[model samples]
Target: MTDKNIIWHKVLDDKKELPEGRVKTVTAAHKGICLTHYKGKFSALDNRCPHQGGPLGEGSIENGLLRCPWHGWDFDPCTGHPPGGYDDGIDTFPIKEENDAIFVGLEPEKPHETTVSDIMVETMINWDVTKVFGMVGHSNLGFADAMRRQEEKGNLNFYGIRHEGAAAFAASAYGKLTGKPAACFSIAGPGATNLYTGLWDAKVDRAPILAITGQVKTQVVGTGNFQEVDLVQGFNTVAEFNQRIQRDSRHAELMSLAIKHAILKRDVSHLTLPDEIQELKASSRAKAKTSKNRITPLTIAPPKEAVDEAVKLIKKAKRPVIIMGHGARNHKKEVVKFAERLNAAVLTTFKGKGLISDDHPLGGGVLGRSGTPIASWFMNECDLLIVFGASFSNHTGITPKKPIIQVDFDPLALSKFHQVEVAVWGEISRTLEIFQEEIKGETSAINPRNEIAARWKIWKEEKTKRLSETSDKGISSIAIFEAMNKVTPENAVMCVDVGNNAYSFGRYFEPKNQDFLMSGYLGSIGFALPAAIGAWAAVGNSRPVIAVAGDGGVCQYLAEITTLVNYNMPVKLIIINNNELGKISKEQRAGEFEVWKTALSNPNFAEFAESCGAWGKRVEHQEDLEQAMKELYDQSKPSVLEIIADVNLI
Candidate 1:
C-alpha cells in the first residue's frame, strides 16, 4: 500500500520479545494486528479470526499453520489466507523490521464523526452533569470515548473506579451533596447489576443520580447473547426514568428526560446503550438539548389555610422543637432562622446531624436511636413538634402522639409513615418564610437554650465516664471519635458506613457545620469510602472529605483506596477495627442467639494503605490516638487511619 496519509507506530523494540513460531497481538493506529515470526520472517495480519472474531494472536502454530484458538481454524503462517479451500481471508498490513525493532504502518486516524453517544453525552453535559464514575470496557467504548472528548474540552471529568458499585455510590453522594445529577457508567450484565445497592440508596434518600449501562448488540439481545441482560426491566424498580436507547430514539431528548426525571423527582434515572447502536451517526438536524427553559423553579408556597393552621399551632406552643431531616439539607439556614425566631429547640435526625451547628444555643444533637440525651429529652418534654423536610422514619422517632406540623416540598413525604396534625406541602425555605411572616412575632414559646445547655453538659459527663471503659479486646470507640472530633476540620464532609461505628459517630462526634452523607433508608454497608470519593469529586480540595467505616463495611470497598490514590484525592479514611461484624453480633445477642460467623479475619489495613501508595497509621491506644490522627491527617494525599476499638464499648 502507498504510504500517503500513513502513520507508523512501533510494535516491538526487540525481535527476541517474540520467539520463533510465536504470534503476538499488537495495536497499530488503533487496529489490532497479529504479528507473527515464522521461517525467520515477520508478517502482520488482521487479529480477528473472521468467523467468530476470536483473537488469532492467541492461537497456536501447529504443523506450520497458525490455528485459531476458538474454533480450530487454520491459516497460512506467512500469508493472510485461511487454507487452500477457504474463501475467507484476513487483510495484511505493512510491517518493517529495522535495527532489531518492528514497526507497523497504517493510515492516520480519521476525524471522529458525531455519533449517538456524542449527542447524548453533549446533552448530558449541557444539563450540567459534570462528573461520571465507572470503568471503561469493550461494550461501553463509544460512550467512554465521547466522555473523553468532553474531558479534553474541560466540560466534565471521568473517574475510573475499582468497581461499578463504587461508581454508583460515588455518583449518589455527588447528587446528594449538590442536588445535581452525576452519572455512573458500566458495561452490560454483571457490571450493571453491581450498581444495585448504591442506586437503591440514592432512590430511598431522594438523591438525583443517572446510571448508564451498555447492552449486547440489539439484534442479539434476546438470543442469549454474551454479556446480555434485560437492563431496562432490571432497573425498573430503582429508577424513575428507565429507557433503552435505540437508533431511531431522539437521543438528546432521551438524555434530557433522564436528567429531568432524576432532578425533578429526586431519584435515579437509568439508560441502557446497546453496543452496536452507540456508534450510529447522528442526523445533522439533531442538536443537543440544554437546561435553558427546560426546568421550572420548585418554590411553591403552601395554601393560606395550611399556613393559618401552622401559625395558630405555633402561637399556642409553649415548648416547641423543630426537627430537620436530610430533606432539609438545602434549606437549613432558613430552618435555623425559624428555630431562633420561634425560640424553639432545634433537633436533627441522624441523617441531618449537621443541619444545625451543635454550638448554636438552640441546637440539640441528633434524635432517635443514634441520638443524645438532649434530643430525646426535648422530644419527651416538648408540647409542639415542627418537622421540616423530615420523613418521620422510625430511626428518627418523631413522636406520633404529639401535635405535629410537617412541611416538605414533596407532598407525599409529609406524614409519610403516620398522620400529623398539619401537613404543609410547599418548598421548605418558602414554607418557613410564610410561617415566619404569618406568625408576626406572636408566640408563647420560651427559649430553651439553658435547658439544652444543661442536657448537653449531662450528656458530656456521661460520655466522659464511658470513655474510661476498657476492654481487653481493644480501645474504646468514644476515645477514637473524641480524637477525631478534636482534630477533624469543622467544615469537613463526612461519609459514614452502616454499623456500630456510624452509631458511635452519631452519638459522640458533635457536629459544627459539618455535613454528613450516609445510606439512610437502604442502610447499605461499604458506603463510606465510595461516598467519600463522590464528596471529593463534588468539592474537590476546597473542603476536607472524611470516611468512617467499621471493619466489616470497609472490606466491601477496600480496593477503592487505590482509586483515591489514582485520582490524587486526599480523602481521610477512618476504619474502626473490632475484627468482626460487630453490629450483627450485637443484634444476635439481643435476640438471645449465639454469635456465629460474624467474626472476621483482617489484614493490617494501615500497611495495605501504605502499599497502595497512600499514607497510613494504626492507633491501638487512647493515648496514641490524637498523635496518630494528626499524622494521618497531615498527609497531603489519600490516607487511612485504622483504629483498634472495642465493639462493646460503642
Candidate 2:
C-alpha cells in the first residue's frame, strides 16, 4: 500500500506538448517537480539542483541524462542520482499517466514555520509602522510574503508604485505629514539606487523614513552576482543607521533599532535583506520589540541664562520679528502664543509657508526669494529677530547682521553658519513657552501686527497689478495662483514641486490653516505628485490633497498619475504648463547668458489625465481658471487642472 499522506496532482493535460526524450518542470502540491520522458517511460524528480539551487527541470537532456543549465552538472534522469556516484541525489516523486495526462504524487507539506522576515515585520508593526510604499520583485518575494501576511491581519498597508523613486518620495511625504516612519522598499542595485534622490529629500528635510532593500544572497554578496550592489556603502551618507540583515543576527532587534533610530533622530534608517536570509526559519522564542519605555519625551526646556538673554533682547528692541521654519511645524500653537505675547510679526521661510495661517493678524508671508516683498520689508525694519527652528539658508535671506536669538532642539543647528546674539538649545515649543512666561512686563518693543497688515495691503495691490499683465504668449502665473487661492479648500494639504511653480505659489497663494509639504533642503523636482499620494495615504479623504507642479516637474513622474487613479486618492494636481524650464531661463538671463535647452514640448496634460481614468480640464484663459479649479476640487476622485501659463511672466 502507498503512503496515505501522498496526494496526486495532475499537471500536464497532454504529454505530446513535452515531446519524447525531453524534460520539463511542473508544479504539484505547490512544489516544483521535474518530469522526464526517456525511452517511452516517464519519471518525476525534485526540480531544484543539489548545487547552487538551480532549476534542474529547465535543463536539457543530453547523452541519456539530465544536465543542469547553470553549471552543466549531470544527473540520471530516471533515478534521482548524480553522475559518477557523487553520493548526492535529488528527491524523486511518484509519477503516473492516466488518460493522456501526467500526474505527480507529493506528500502533505509540514505546518508553515515563521521566517526571519515574519519576525522583522512583526517588530516593525510593534513600533507602529503601518504604511509601506514599494515595488515587489524576484529578490524581495519572501519579504513581500511576510508583508502580505501583515496586510491580511490588518496591521499594515502596502502600496505598489510604478518606480522606486516614487516609493521613496511617498514614504518621505508620509513621514513628514504624520511625524512617524513609513517604509520604502526596493530590490538591490538599480532599484535601490533609484531611491537615493527621495531618501536625500527626507534626510535633509528631517523626515523619518525606513528604507528596506533586497540584496543578493550572502554567499554571492562579494562575488559580483547579477543585480547585486554594496547597498550599505551606497546608502551610507543618506541613512543615519545602515545595516545588513544576516542569519546569525538578532532579526527582530535589528528592526527595532532601525525604527528607533529613524523616529528618534528624524532621519532615514536602512536595512539590507539578503535573498537567502529573508526566508530563514526564525528562533521559536523570538519576540518583537516595542516603544514602551524606549522613547523619551522631546520637550526639553531652555537654560535659564539663554532664556534671560533672549528676554533682554526682546525687551530692548522697538521692532521685533519671529521667523519659523519647517522644524516648527509640530509646535505651531506654542509658537503662535509666543509671537502673540510679544506682539511680534510672524514670518515664515518658503518651506515653512503654512506654519502660521496667512489670515492671522501677525502673519507676514514667506520671507525670502520666493516670498512677498511684505516679509522682506518687515525683516528690514526689525531691530530684533527671534528665530525658531530655522536654517538660515541663502534661499531664505534671514539677515545675519541683525541681533538674533535662535532656538532649536538640535545644538548643532544653532548658528550653523554664523553667530547670533543668543543661542537657546532646547525643544522649540518649550523654549517658546518659557519666553511667553518670562516676558510678562515688557513694554519697549513695538507691536508689528499693524505694520504687517499695512505691508500686506501694499503687496496685495502689487499682486493685483501683476495679475493684469497677461499676454497672448499664455495666461499669467499671477492669474493662475489667484484662481487657486479662490478655489482651494482652507484645510487642504499642498505638495509643491521645485521650480517657478513653487516660487509663484509662495508669492501668490495665501494659505489658511493648511499644511504645506515640499522637498525643502534637497529641492528636488518631481516631488509633488508622489508626495500628494503619500499625504492622501496619511490623512485619507478627510482633507483635500493638492499637488502643484510645472510641466517639466510633472513629466518626471507622470506615471504616478495612474497610481493615483488606481487608488482613487482624490488628489487635485495643478500643472502650470509653461512650455519651458522657467526658473532656469530666469537664472540664465540673470547671469547674462542666452536661454538654451530650456524649451520643452508638452502634451495635452488634461487629455493624458483623462486617459488614466481621472477628471481633467485644461484652462487656457484666465476667465475659465476659477471654474475649472472649482470643478476639479469638488470631485471625489483624482483630477488634473492644467493651466497654460506664460513662461516669461512667471
Query: Top model by TM-score, which number?
Result: 1
Q: Which ten residues in a row have the lowest lDDT in candidate 1?
A: 1-10
Q: Per model, state how many residue pairs clash.
A: 0, 0
lDDT of 2: 0.91
lDDT of 1 at 120: 94
Give the per-residue lDDT digits (tens) of candidate 1, residues 153-252. 9999999999999999999999889999899999999999999999999999999999999888898989988888899999989999999999899999
Q: Candidate 2 at residue 197, lDDT?
A: 96
Top candidate (lDDT): 1
TM-scores, each model vs. reference: 0.98, 0.91
lDDT of 1: 0.92
Q: Write the per-residue lDDT of candidate 2 for residues 475-549, one digit (tens) a residue.
A: 988888898888789999999999999999999999998899999989999999999989998999899999999
